[model samples]
Target chain A: MSLEIEVFATLNGIPDEAINNKTVIVIDVLRATTTITVALAAGCLEVIPVLTPEEAIEMRERLGDERVLLGGERNALKIPGFDLGNSPLEYTTEIVAGKRLIITTTNGTRAIRRAAGGRLVFLGAMINAPAVAGLAATAATDITIICAGTRDRFSLEDFLTAGLLVDQLAGQGEFVLRDGALAARDYYYCHRADPAAALKASFHGRLLADLGMEADVEFCSRVGATDVVPVYGGGIIKKAS
Target chain B: MSLEIEVFATLNGIPDEAINNKTVIVIDVLRATTTITVALAAGCLEVIPVLTPEEAIEMRERLGDERVLLGGERNALKIPGFDLGNSPLEYTTEIVAGKRLIITTTNGTRAIRRAAGGRLVFLGAMINAPAVAGLAATAATDITIICAGTRDRFSLEDFLTAGLLVDQLAGQGEFVLRDGALAARDYYYCHRADPAAALKASFHGRLLADLGMEADVEFCSRVGATDVVPVYGGGIIKKAS
Candidate 1:
């Protein structure tokens, strides 16, 4: 089975037709996807991404607070009354087990909701790039990497992750890349030499630094921290068993 | 002085702040911007891009048919009464000089109008990449590259051109790149090895080829055919002296 990989640098860059019948890999390296991956890897059962903070709260109210942990941010700061902000470090295994997280991040999780129609796979900087790449290769359908860019715009961090994934896949030599996929691979190579420098110089990175989340930038830039690949099937993103 | 380059893979990928205080370069390599650039470089005095054919007719009625040439396409095919379709080959110098061409393209020109608030520039497969790079390098303000993606979605051809422009600017070595600019350059390097393959694999490129415009694809892929850089100032696009 030939798997066609399509890389979108921003959520807005997603093609209308490519959304159908594909396994979509949603990546938001700076925080949202990173936070979710960490939360799940840390032993949180599942995370439900909502479009807005109010929607997260509403979902929480329905699911009941005892089992659900409220998470997310507004302008990179923790939401008021939220049990957690969008920090991967906050999601420790000791703090979150068998709990459902209602999350609404500034860019990442919201992008996840917009891409709800596809068979979704969530990725972040912490995940092993090779693992994500392997998952993409074996998916048996077209792979569309939807970079959950910052605020409807292209983010370098997200695109960089996509590039890394493409790079891993290209090394396998098992798949035929479309132009978008090849482009992603090239982008990864361009920034691979100095990722930290690339991250610090990005628009979102600077903004995150300005918001006092410089630590998040460092955290998200780490490649292959988790072998756990979170797959979104039927609207809920969970660790692939 | 610092020059910023904003790359848009899709109309939706446009950054919020890019709409303000930047010289916007419109790129629709499949056609639109390519056609305009070709027409102007071929000696068309001025090309007025409108959103609709009705407007072209209105302009024709108001400006008189003696000098007005109706151009553009609905689906890569020429409008019923228009003088041209959205093809670079159709814009050869012998036919377009000293003429007022009323044009409406599928994506490129519309994007230019949409982001009209910024200082406007035109980019395509043919002409003035280095000059555009030079202009961007010397520019004191941020530059936005608006890619006329296929049908409100991201097209690889346009994004690749944006990347190439970004790559050239990065090579200039005197300017610091914003994250967006760097991302565009990364995208360029990703697609630079084979522009024809990149274009053929794009959503718009396939559509054009299916409609029997293989020649247009070749024409659109030729880089640096002309050094005349088109700039949109005073609400109309013309050659920047």
Candidate 2:
């Protein structure tokens, strides 16, 4: 029997039963997962994914503010009084290295939390797509790619990232692609040539451009730019050691 | 300003604000909407979409069952005690003509009801896509295409049907394609040549084929085969007059 893969454009409407026994790849390409990938690659100790900005603040208080940094966004702008925003480029090695990162966003963190039933949950984005897919393929018999769509709506950027991962994963071995996977795989095939253009065309991507964060979109658009696959367990995400 | 178009793979997360003042096109190509279009074209008096088989039966009882037909499916099979299943082939002129269809399905009917806030609601499928799009473009300044996804998950056939509608609507006039519309439009572009193949590859399509309904899939795959655009108003759907 071949492996089975399902892709979800958003986390809404997914039943709890769908996640059990499957390995999940959570994506929020513009730019929660992308930012997390960058933070981990830059040597951040770990990422604490909370659902809301208020929760992020509370977590920071409990963790103590010394070596921890808060990062997130609402409406594509940095949260007030946070260490950083959702832009991936802000997590340079010098800025995030050796720090504990607590992150939340308008959509990504909630999606990560809701995908908790999966036996294994790995954060995947265009930046670490190839490596994430390579690692995830061997993790379980079933794989679910859950895209953190913008504000509970299907975001094109995340769906496209799923397509990218599906395309790469298809090369590994034979697999049964479910409806969402088939759609994303085909969409990825259609838009794979110009990932950056695809991102720039997305709703969040255009919003980011309007906010002068095109650099973030460009940074998140580079497929396989890094090989860091952040795994989540017990509400914490860390680089696979 | 040009028209605005947004396509939803499923009706789950659509906000009421999104539907306000927009013409909505509800699609369920395999085969709720397809069946409705066929029944209407065959001269069914009207299609009253209810949420459940029980509701369909109740509605039939309330209406005195005279010249009334109950049609629906559960898990793509005929609902028990219903006069007909969801297969478009069964909704022939000989069977449905002059009858009132109290119709229900697992997903399609709920989608049609949920789009109640729309300024105008039109059912569009591959069978009558071109005419629906042409008429819908003139009915309102904004259009929202809602796909009745299979069991609250993204259904490839519905998405493809939405893509086909988006593609046809694009040709009718200039429009600003939102994220969902852009994704559907691109998906349609990828698989426009052979829709039957697309349908066969979907989760529900394969199930119907397994249940000996390959002919139904082929029947729904033919684009622009009819000009019957069913419009829903005042809780009843009838051929556009």
Best-fitting candidate, scored by TM-score? 2
lDDT of 2 by residue, B56-153 (tens): 88888889968999999998899889999999999888999999999999988999998888899999899999999999988757999998898768
Write candidate 1's Cα lDDT for B195-237 as tens digits: 7776777766777889888878877887777777777655566
Give the per-residue lDDT of model 2 (tens digit) for A1-241.
7788888887778867678878999999999999999999999999999988899999889977699999999888999999999999899999999999999898999989988888999999998999999998887568899988877577999999999998888888688898999999999889988979989999889999999999989989988899999999988999986
**Compared with the real two-chain complex, what DockQ does model 2 have?**
0.80
> In candidate 1, what are the lDDT values of residues A1-241, reduced to their tens digit?
6667777767774665677777777887778888888888888998888878898888888876698988988887899999999878789988777898888887887677767677555554535567777776776777777888777667787778888887887676566676556666767787787777778788878988898878888877788877877777676888877
Instruction: In candidate 1, list every pair of residues with a backbone clash.
Output: B43-B97
lDDT of 1 at A98: 83
User: Chain B, candidate 2: TM?
Assistant: 0.98
